[model samples]
Target: MSREVAIRVENLSKLYRLGQITTGTLTHDLKRWAAKMQGKEDPFMKVGEENDRTKKGGSDYTWVLKDINFEINKGDTLGIIGKNGAGKSTLLKILSRVTAPTKGEIKIKGRIASLLEVGTGFHPDLSGRENIYMNGAILGMTRHEITRKFDEIVDFAGIEKYVGTPVKRYSSGMYVRLAFAVAAFLEPEILIVDEVLAVGDAEFQRKCMGRLKDVSVNDGRTVIFVSHNMTAMQSLCNRTIMLERGQIKMTGDTDTVINHYLNTYVSTSSTKVWDEHESSGNDYARLRSVKVVDDEGVAISNSFIEEGVNIETTYQCLEEGSKLYVSLVIKNQKDDLIFISSSISEDVWSMNPHPLGTYKTTCKVPGNLLNDITYKVTVFLIRNSTDVVYTAEDIIIIEKTDPGNNRRGLYGKWGGLVRPILDWRTIKL
Candidate 1:
């Protein structure tokens, strides 16, 4: 027995003009003309540009995705990862048939359902039920197929009450719920999901992941997922693809691809200082500097497993008698939360209101508690526990190089979020 190929993309490339790509298709051009003659906005016109943000693009034309090639096996889930302007979403759009490639062709075996972005493939005035039937019909499913899955979709979305409301009036979270439900439940052979799931809350994210696992494992459906959440990606995907500057940077197993993507893209920093003009804060307070130091209180980017880390943050108070508390949430390379250390929990600044001055605080993280991996610090400053003064995600990266685990075994890497040495007492029996 042999596995079947579900999707085959060959030399796929998409060229776009700076502001908008003019449709070269004759039928679309005629449709635009007809729409204009009818005194309505041209339905063919959509506004988007190539994703390059590194510098001012020289030419008016750019290849958003170029010469990309990959093959997905049936019943397999592929995870696509890249930074901004790296052509992650563009690839998904091309796969979902929301857009066409300028050069090459994509050979897909069966029907495709995609939730590319919020409110995509949905009409503004139509109810959720209408959209489900429409999507099913578009995917070549009959009305019976849609009707059989209607209640399941509604229950999964948890929007039974709002199913009658127009999707345009729904909140962003509601929009994603309905969109994902329709795409996942309507039974398309291939599922193309974008980062729209990021809009959902944490619990919904877990539920969606579970559903995705079932679709791939039990139903033998192929899926392509794009997200910035590495933990979800690692858990759901058997294979991974990384895109960079409209090119396929790497395609391999999940671990290798994720590690390469993170290590190649991780920023090396022990401190981040913001100038007043460059400050991302408001009038209440502003961040002065945040640094990660070693055991001796010296700042460094690279640290060993035996040596602990000390994180320090400094902020300048602009208003007098303003209450500000700082905290740091740490995560590993896979975006797994290790722990959160807060000034309020440490009884440092929760009881006092600071005057207009510079305040510096530090927290010592013990060694041998964390596995050797890249750690990121998300900084948060809150007032009254409701108002967020300033919050920065992954502002500082602490690279922990493990010298050795001292374990005598064939296992090369320790498996867990943290590597804490547990206390054990043995009694002779």
Candidate 2:
């Protein structure tokens, strides 16, 4: 038997006008008239360098998504992974018709239901029971079908006591649980889910994953899941699709695709900096710059675990007479914080005053301390235990390697924040 295509997207693109009024207005009308007469797209449609609002001088009309093309077969579970603003949600939105594409075409078969946000089809004034039925109908389910799944939906959501309560009264977690329950129970031919599970508790997320697995494997449905949680994505998806700046970066087997996405799609060191002029926030000072160097004092962009290296972060004090505290957080490629050390931890400074000037702090990561993998560094500045001057996350990239293990243990099952090499003793048991 030949495989059936559940979804086919060809040259799909989405565009938006930057720095313009979205709704009707006299100014917008005049601009549109002038642009049409001049035979131009939109005055705001200037294609060039992209800006990151998360950083300084970022672009206004950041392309949340651009041209994208992919195919998902029946019963295939496709995982979408990328950093924030990589257009993962935008692609899923276009696929589910929550938003129309700016260009290209998409062919989808059977009924499609998307759980893009909490209380998606739910009316805040309506009771839970009513919203379930309403959402079921919206998903193309008949009255009888909804009736059969009503109890299971309520039970799975674990909100039986508040069945008749207005959805507005429900907490965020409750709202998502009820909304997800309705979407998942209806058993649509194509299921589109965003990062809804991220807000749920750990146990709830596990339960939802289990139910989704059953739906895709046993019921032979197609699923498109977008999430930042790499471990969960790897566990649930057989195939993976990675997106970067609205373009498809990689698509292949789950492990290979996810790894490629992590290694390649993540922010490069040269692209991200911790300069004081570029980065600032509440609670602490600002990170002036971050750099890594070897024993010979040569600047290094990447390093192996066996190479002991020096990591340095420069900071600037914006105000005088404020307690200064700074921390360095190291995380693995999965975005999990491995170790966080702060100036407070060392007790190097008391109520002492720090002059308003630039200063650099360095930490040494000795060889053999870290296993082979990609890691990131985040810098934070705190003042008086409450004020946060600055916090810059995922600003630096570090690579580690253990030639003896052959990279197998680097992605091993022994999960934790760190993979340390401690001495062991075995007395013949």
Candidate 3:
């Protein structure tokens, strides 16, 4: 890939007013506008609070995005990730020219196409075919160029049958497919996408992901993708940036950024107890609590690598004739799942009907099986091996540290995720 800068953002920020009346917002904008009219600096640029939707801020205007900065290479793909209200969509909107920043500026080298929220860049009254032509025109494409790529776009979208239908009547999946197809095939130098694939099924999601890769790799385009799907981000993006509360948190390689995001921003617990008011299951079952316990049945946050661990889950079964089984997922600090165990792993629990009653299940974790690191456990209650009755993701976490008691001496760093002691007899004859 060429090292030429395709896009550069410097000190970007977005401010929004909370209530219906944007008097405060208008005041700030008017102040900025008057200053600009006088050829003076904008005064209300950096005076907004952070955009945290949870807690109420003192200011009427909050910065949806604050001091954001990044540079993209000509053909590099960058992934942006964060929780809700983290200014992900705002950033994309600013880049697509749908919204203007309150402060700072972005420099672009080429035409840009963005597939943001649902029904973006499309008229409800226009047919899919007409919208395609319109979007192409907006991207600086001539009618002849659009016509040359029309068939390919329709075919790739798998909506040739609905090409003439009004996009308002199309399903969400169909809308996203057509939107993504247009954004990708329109020949824009930089393509920006934001969580639109979540509206489609897994198959269509895979197709869109493949198209993203092809656009960046085969066509030498820059792509900026925003999604909560870590797997897709890791697969498609070579580099990533994580945002938190309208600010940039981390920016680097995809794996490193994703790891930091999962371990730090993602919430985890060592023990969880559900209250009666909280509902975690359907009519079939209800989860009560999940915890990591030692051999003596006492919950412990610190566990050794050379010792056994137990995961205890308690739940109340509600319906009769429900063949319920438990599944446990063990993951390391990086959110990489180490192993998964189902109740059916034991012959006794396979295909057995769990009657309605309060029950507690315990799963054992052997020593020398996992590396020295912190681990989280996710619990799932399944019925008939198909239906999920209840689930608590990352219900508990445990810190597994090395105690130097294993057969492998604590000399050099032990690689890999596990530390199993295999049977080996060296023969020197």
Candidate 4:
């Protein structure tokens, strides 16, 4: 059996004029209108460059998205990831029909309820209760249908006391909560959410994630999610697409796409070194180098999951009697922090002050402890156990490969941020 497509985008592109809202002067608009009447392409569409914000282009036009083609299958959850200004919101808006694409077409099979931004569909003068019904009506839900879900929506949003208040007076968090509740409860066939969820509290965010997953899994609805939180993306989306400068750079399983984005777009390396003239530090201490090493103390960027790796940092203390300690923060490709270790736990040097001299701190990460993924290491130097003196953020990147030796015959991708070989025993009852 073949899967049905929920949404199909073909040759989708969006172009915008710089420093102006309208397309251009009335004369340009007339020319575009004439071209449309003549069944010819717009004259200005061929003059713009890709939407690269860093570089200066000669033309006044820029393509926010170009040649974008993709399909979302029914009941599939899709994630869109990219750096800032990568045209993520533009694509979502186009799909939601909030804006028209400059060229190409998008065919959608179901009613789309979008939570694009805070208060996107809510009326400021209207009460939350009124807005809920209004949004439902816009989604083609009957009054009876909206009435049936009204209580559940208000209850889920935790705004029972303020449901009758004008939404303009609501806090940003409340606006998001109620907006999300309305969008999710309206029973739209397709749901589109942008990074607006970040405005809510952590608990509310978790609730939204749970609801998103429930709608896709239990209700068989299609979902498109956009977020900078990699951990959330990994947990919610089975497949993901990475956008670079308004184009799809890669699309595949969540793990593969996320790993590629982290390794390729993110600036990281296996080793970071500062010369004698340039270093990262204050007046008290200076960082010289940070790197990942093998058991033999040789620098290596790649290692097997079964072979533990070591992180080493070298620094020099400029002042005598400086109470300093080193700390290491390890994060996976999904940008989820695995663990943080500090030398302040040491018994001898932790409490005592240090004399002026060069020092090396090594943290041993045992094998079978970390999952097979790319890891970024950040080094922190603290003085007097409270003040952070020097910091090297994401300076060292390490890739851990799964050799299958520790799989114990099991196959497929292992779950969790850490894959430790814990002790387990079982007996038949």
Candidate 5:
């Protein structure tokens, strides 16, 4: 069976003038006008550099998106993941028609309802009830259609009491709730949402996730979601695209793309060390180094799934007689916490006040306990039992690979964070 494409992008690209707007001078505008009149390409379109923010470019223009091409099928949920300046918002804005592309074209087959930002289609002075109707009408909804879904929108947003209130007076959370409700309930053929949903509470985020899932899975609508929350992306998106420096880095299933993005862009290693001036901590203590090691005390980035792995941290205590302990938090690629272990369990250092000196703490993770996957380690330095002196989040990353020694001929992927070996006796009753 052939699937219908909801959106198609061909050689899409966007360029921006650096430092100043309006092309910096009237001469450039006149040149662009002349080129358009002659049906010729813009003279400046070929002069811009790739959108790498870290480098100094000689050109006055930068290509925010370059030669992007993709197709989104109907009823499919697509995820876009990237770093801070990866042009994700720019792509979404272009798709929503908030801005025009510098070159190339996009074919959108249906009406697009976008929640790009808070109060995207809402007027501040207008009441929530009025904005809902206004947004629906903008999507080509008839008055009767808007009226029919009005109550449901209000109920989903949980803002019936404030329905009559002007949206200008609403909080950020309220604004997002109303905006999402309007976008989701207006029955647009395609929905585009950005990271603005992070403004809502946890329960609201979960609700919105469920609504997005239902929108694509059950309602047969196309969805484009952009978020830094990997867990949500993995849960909702069937396909994902990774963007880097305004270019498509990879495209495939949700897990593979997400993992590639994490390993490539998100800095992770088995060892992390800080110089004296760059150390992490307060005046009382400082963290100097963190690394993952094996039973032989050799620092390593890869470990066998059947051997124990040790997380080691070295810190200097500056204040005399200060009670301190080290802690570790492990998380998978989806940013889900696997477990947290504290050095307070050690007999020698647990709640013990020590003289000013350097100390090393090691936490050993037993073999056959963790599944074969990439895990990030976070280190926390605590004062006494309650106060946290410093936290080094995701300071180190370790890859646990299966050596096939304990597989017993079964090579399928295991589920969950841990794959422990349990002693089970099977007997016929």
Candidate 6:
């Protein structure tokens, strides 16, 4: 690889045997070796040999990843994205050196730092200050190098009070902050991060993403980021790689890949009608169905900012005389919960008592407060603090459009969780 090319991949392929184990002993290995002496690869590599546990007779071989090829130039941030089982994480793991590719070759030409897991190089017994040095050393930073950036890392982590305390006592959020700060400040030539921001709060996630952008642009380093948050991927990365079932489905600019992923995701059925026995995995009540319709009672997911949203939820009451409550959770495209409506609140409408039958609860969101983005709807059914009847997350998606006249006003001046118009009262003193 040349100096401009930070990483190069050449026809990489990874195949995994589904349900059989290759013995390391001499006897079974000799038999397999003898068979392999012929003009053939592993028997598992044959076509149409994938295992089917639900079937009667099937082979126990499958391919997790087939032929793949790509290259990452210096100062390029490549965003890897796909559905849940789309081999995104597997590819990151391979590139991070957590696992080796079964075939082909990858040429990496610089020191690498990967934030693949939460608290990846952290020791529970070590203090926060000590763990910083430990992780920095793991990233090939010397003592002097760490000392030079020590204050910067500490300030970035925002855990100065707990730096002397043992990391085992820190909360998950604190641990994530410290860990991310160390990795970011280490200044490796190549950085690989996989959903590391999913753990922290919204403010911390914003900080982490800002730092990542700085590293990619200001420091002129290569970054490989994997995230299910499509909006984050859209804003942070210039190039995107879409993977599906261990194969490279598409690779191109950020807009194209994001549109491809979102279009595919939205085309799928988002609602299901539930009968009496259906449950949302909660013990309180079972959900019958969920729908987002307008005044005319038409089910739709996409909506303009000026339009009203009516969320209809149907639930089954198994026991009589129990208080059933419903709540709404609104999450932004970044998968961050922006607003939550619970029955415990006094400002909103109260949950009327329903008899032992199916009930429909509808909540309307005023259009003016939202910006142009996608929001996921989550419903919660509960009684008291102890009784959670049902909880359905990512049930419906609502898209807001830019209906205002001032396009520039909504563009860059303020980017935040809420886009409300505040009345300013100014008096000349």
Candidate achieving the largest TM-score: 6
lDDT of candidate model 4 versus the reference: 0.86
Error of 2 at 5 (Å): 2.0
Position 186, candidate 5: lDDT:
77
Q: Which tens-of-lDDT digit does each residue in 372-400 have in candidate 5?
A: 88888889999878888899877788788
C-alpha lDDT (0 to 100) for residue 423 of candidate 1: 85
How large an RMSD does model 3 have?
Answer: 8.7
Alpha-carbon TM-score of each model against the true structure: 0.66, 0.72, 0.63, 0.63, 0.66, 0.74
> Which rank order by TM-score, best down to worst?
6, 2, 5, 1, 4, 3
Clashing pairs in 4: none
Where is model 1 more than 4 Å wrong at Cα? Answer: 1-4, 19-52, 118-142, 155-179, 196-203, 268-289, 294-296, 301-308, 313-329, 337-372, 378-395, 399-429
Q: Clashing residue pairs, candidate 3?
A: 270-397
Instruction: Show model 3 residue runs off by greater than 4 Å.
Output: 22-47, 118-126, 138-140, 168-172, 270-429
The worst-scoring run of ten residues by lDDT in candidate 3 lies at 345-354
User: Residue 247's C-alpha lDDT in candidate 1?
Assistant: 87
**Which has the better lDDT: candidate 4, or candidate 6?**
4
Considering TM-score, which of the candidate structures 1 and 4 is the better prediction for this target? 1
List, residue by residue over 1-429, the lDDT tens digit for candidate 2. 789999999988766544666565466668868998999886544552342435533444455565677898999999988777777777887887878986689999998988787566679999999999998888778999999999999999999999999999999888888988898999789998888777777788889999989889999999999887787788789999887767787889899988787767565672245443443654335666776777776668766666787777666666676677677788877765578777665455533467777666667878767666767887777777766677676777776545555345455444445456678798987
Candidate 3 CA-lDDT value: 0.83
lDDT for each residue of candidate 1 in 1-429, tens digit (9 for 90 to 100): 689999999998887766554664555568769988999875633333344766666555577887899999999999999887788888888888778887798899998877676445578788888877776676567899899999998899888998888888888777777777776787889988787667787887888889989999899999898888898899999999999889898999988999999888766687898887875568988888899987676889887777788898888778888888888999876666788988886665663688888888888888877777778898997766667889877889887777774565546777777777688799999
Q: Model 2 clash pairs? A: 51-59, 52-58, 282-388, 283-387, 283-388, 283-389, 284-388, 284-389, 285-389, 305-401
Model 6 C-alpha lDDT per residue in residues 4-118, reported as the tens digit of each score: 8899988776655554464633444575587789856755456432223234346444455667899999999999988766777778878888788877889999988888876
Candidate 6 residue-wise lDDT at 225: 96
lDDT for each candidate structure: 0.81, 0.76, 0.83, 0.86, 0.88, 0.76
Better of 3 and 6 by TM-score: 6
TM-score of 2: 0.72
How many residue pairs clash in model 2?
10
